[model samples]
Target chain A: MRITELFDNGEFVVTAEVGPPKGISADHVVEEAKTYLSGITAVNVTDNQSSVMRMGSLPACVALKNAGLTPILQLTCRDRNRIALQSELLGAAMLGIDNILCLTGDHTKMGDHPGAKPVFDLDSVSLLHTACQLEKGVDLAGNPLVGEAPKFAKGAVVSPCSDSVDAQLAKMERKVMAGAEYFQTQAVFDSEKFIQFMEKAKQFGKPVQLGVIIPKSAGMAKFMNKNVAGVHVPQWMIDELAADKEKAKAGITGVELAAKVIKECRPYCQGLHIMALGWEAKVPELLKQAGI
Target chain B: MLITELKNKDTILSLVSGKVFIINCHGCKDIHFPEQEAEALQKELAAGGNVTGIFTTDYICNPENLKLRLGYHAEAIAQADMILVFSCGVGVQTVAAAYEDKKVCAACDTYALPGYQGVTPLEHDCKQCGECFLNLTGGICPLTACSKSLVNGQCGGAKDGKCEVDPDMECGWERIMRRLAQVGRLDALKCPVQVRNYATDDEVKSK
Candidate 1:
């Protein structure tokens, strides 16, 4: 089905991202994914999201699909050039993967073993344009494909709380013009700030999904606020999580906070993309409590 | 850049400048390609353009070798505005660490290679992280071998068993199937398997 159909249906659209494992067939990863598939509209399979090479994203996506769930394949430009990127897109189309999230990956220097090299031949913007070309059955250099190209419901990322919000908006506009059908923002905490950013994003007339991270612990919230780019966890929320010394109580409090955010942002966003990190199982309860 | 292999101390010392310096391991005085790149870069800087510092080092085979190599590249990296790596293997990581603070770029496209070569060459065919599912699915890697990682897929563009992406190469899965058939292991294609997550926190050091 087309992304437009999915959006118009307004089905409390919940999407979760699952990281593939490094070794062959680990029951733990599959078990983790199965825990939350029932609560989400689709599950996203990340493509070496942070540039630390892992098992390929496509197979993981296919696994999710095989599990009677819809999967959105996350593709990155850090490793592949225009040619490889286009080929992967076509392959996704053939595999019945209708959803894709485009990204410019982290530099190789960030990965373990800094000796690994990076391929940044094309950044995210160019990748967006390239995807547009493939949808139209042409290559980046303007050559026509020998066969018909596959159609994809393309999406891109934006950090609404970026230090340079204007710069982020400009890139978002570029992505929209380049055939991005939807957008998912980075982790958001401040609803008022997000509302302010949405005032500008509203002009684009495209659907936006608010990114809600399920913090594993109070410390995890603090770490994300300090280290992860474009992610902000309010101190009050952190304190609440810390107030609960027991692990189970902390988990409950964390879910309550996430549910509140989901409720507050529901009116503004078309959907919510939950990044549970390794806490995929808790997502259903969080969503259920939010009345989503 | 005209890359050459460095051979001796005089050649190494001759290449040193505020813009060019020796980037070699300890207990050794030899010139290598990295040194050659440095000399060329020095010339480029002298010619009056905003040029950066260059690397001069070797791919280390041991921890001691790594330390010596890191120490040498760190000096050039500390002083130069940019650091460019021309070789592969441990050299890539060594230079990246030494020049972590500087702008780093690779001159060659890095790929996963076979392990037969002692300390596999930097140019690898696949980034093997020990998630080998190639043993299944006809020896063709749906993850890395296929240009598009499409399982149970062969694009209509496949002509006479060759990939439409490039006529000279066999389709990744097709080649795997052939190899599996040769070994009478075609039954390895059983249930669809999920791709493993080979990434680790250790793999992600910087951002």
Candidate 2:
């Protein structure tokens, strides 16, 4: 089902971020999605996530689709040029992958293959525009597709916790104008800041699914704060995570923290995109504790 | 103008098998020359009697000026086994193409000078993405300013006004927002959706 239909029906959407395997088998992700993330609005399969070469997203998405699951096919501008990108989108559409997540993607410099060429053929906004054009039956060159036009519910990503809120809002307007039907924000840790961003971002009138990353431990929180862009783990949360010196129980505490934030941030967003970050089994527990 | 910096002297010497003629493009003079660095290397190389001749030229990217400048160096260039260029990539390519029969090498490596610059003045890079976002951005060029060249807006990665990719570099969009607010043109950030002209974007990505 398209996320728009979920929204139109007033469903509080929930999604999970899943990475395609480095090898060919999509069975692990498929099984994981089924066992732990059964109720998610859609399973998002990332494209060459973190610039590490992986099995293509479409294969994994197709596997999930074969299992009767709605999959958001993630497309990034890092590896593919416009031609490859559009062709991939068309392929996904033909394969019944209706949800599209368009991203400018992380630079190759940050990825496993720093030497790989970073082809940002189109930034996220332009890609969204192009996706809409394709859905409207015309490609970027204004040429019509020979077959039936593929339809998609194009989605964009945002960083509500960006240092420059005004600039972010400015971009939100562009994304919305570019035909971004929905948004999934970068991992957000600060609800106050997220609330502030949401207050202004409300003007764009698009469904924003806030990302809630579950930090497994104080060490993880600190690492995220220092390394991850757009993710700022607050001192209080770190202190709370650090209080669990037992470490074994800290993972549970981390789920509780994530759930707590999700509860607090619920009103500000149309959905919650949980990024368990390898702690997938705990997501079910986190949602349960959060009373979702 | 292009910024040029001298390459490692050891590497240059290793590449120097025979007589070498050098040309320095001072067109971007006073910007980021590494002139003293180049001269220091030259002084060391000249001590070996391997350097045939050396001269400085301006606007070596200009084909006509390049012809006039190289006209004088024709003899030295012929006498030398290799022609060493100290300029940006464009000037180096121009020299290599002009001297296809000669062994041409770049003695200096060019790095991006943040924002676009020209022959007349040194300003921030424009990227010339064809669809300028400056009018909507209070004259700040997001393509050059932002580390990712993300023109839509600032990414969430910046912290303490620093870029996510490079901690030392200030976040470009933060600067733009500050400037926009300073000029009371914050609304200008949304004047038009900054979709780069497809024709121009294709050209940029091809490189």
Candidate 3:
């Protein structure tokens, strides 16, 4: 079923992210994704997430869709220009990949290739607007389409942990106005803050999926806290994971914390987007532990 | 005016540890230039007899003007082991280019002061993020004015038109919408937001 259909049918939507491998082969990642195919509503394929040059999200999503799974292809403005963005949107639609998540993408300095020139030709808002234009059978320059317009279930990212909630909300409003049908927020650890965000986001009257990350270790939590913008892993969680001596037991604690967060936040959101980092296989266990 | 704070004391003293010549720029006319801070530090350095000479010049960003000042201080410039620049980045680059052999370094980080109108610094700042939305947003820049630098509408973080990040500041979008309402151009908000051409500035800079 289409992701939009799942949302419309009032199925508590579940989505998970798939980071394309650094190299070209998508076979292993696609095979790993199949294990949880029955659990998630859709799988999000990242576009060189963290500015690392990886296999393009398009082909990976195509691979998943070919394997009989719904795929949400992430498109970041950091890599492509408007022309490429519009062209790829149509291309993805042609290959039966409809869902798209627009992002401004992380700056190039955060990636493995810091020397690479950043091409933030468009921010997420403008990309959404362009997607809407393509949906209407026109190009960015208002040129008439030679063929049919692509149909896509457009989505965007929101950060509830933004230092400026007012500014972030204002940006979300613009995204909504431009053509974002849904939003998946950045990974949130603080339930109170996420709940507060939901209280305000509810006013937008759109389907929002809360982001939850499963950290493998205390070192991972601290690293994310320091490196990732808008991701806050509380000190107590860090302390709890740090207190555990065995790494395997710490992994279990991290999963439990993720499940606890999911249980607490599920009421406020329409769905959950589990970003396992690299631990995608354990999502079913997390779902079971959360009693979802 | 662009604000510039002096570099940390340790960094400045270390750079000025050897025979040093100071070049203070009056370029861009930033109201926040720390003349007192520079003077106090200079006095301390002179008390220890580390100072070789000090010179002040306007338009140090212009290499020709800096060259003239360098000519006047040739003796001290030749004697000094290091040239300490208490100016903006542009001035530091200028001094460094003039004397390629000397170890030239900045004593103050240069901040871009926006609202340039024939050399006057305005309170507003423009990040020049390739795409200009100033014509649409009532001349207030969302790139610099908004905390998140978000191009879309406001996030839920604003309360009573004040920014959630800094309550003292007005929300950029709120201000845009209010101004648009006043001008009866609220329809502009509904227009397709343009994709920013990040390459625009890079191309310009390269040229």
Best of the candidates, lDDT: 2
Reproduced native contacts, each prediction: 0.00, 0.61, 0.31
Could you estimate the TM-score for every candidate? 0.58, 0.73, 0.66
lDDT of model 2, residue A63: 95
Q: DockQ values for all predictions?
A: 0.02, 0.35, 0.14
- What are the TM values for chain B, all candidates? 0.34, 0.55, 0.55
Candidate number of the best TM-score: 2
State the C-alpha lDDT per candidate. 0.61, 0.77, 0.75
Rank candidates, DockQ, best first: 2, 3, 1
Backbone collision count in every prediction? 22, 5, 13
Instruction: lDDT winner between 1 and 2, please give it.
Output: 2
Report iRMS (Å) of candidate 1: 18.6
In candidate 2, stretches whose alpha carbon ends up further than 4 angstroms from where it belongs are A247-250, B1-123, B126-133, B197-207
| Tens digit per residue, CA lDDT, model 1, B46-154 | 4753333333444442445556656645654556644433443234334434433433333322223333334433322323332334324432345555544443322
Ranking by TM-score: 2, 3, 1
Weakest 10 consecutive residues of candidate 1 chain B by summed lDDT = B23-32
C-alpha lDDT (0 to 100) for residue A237 of candidate 2: 89
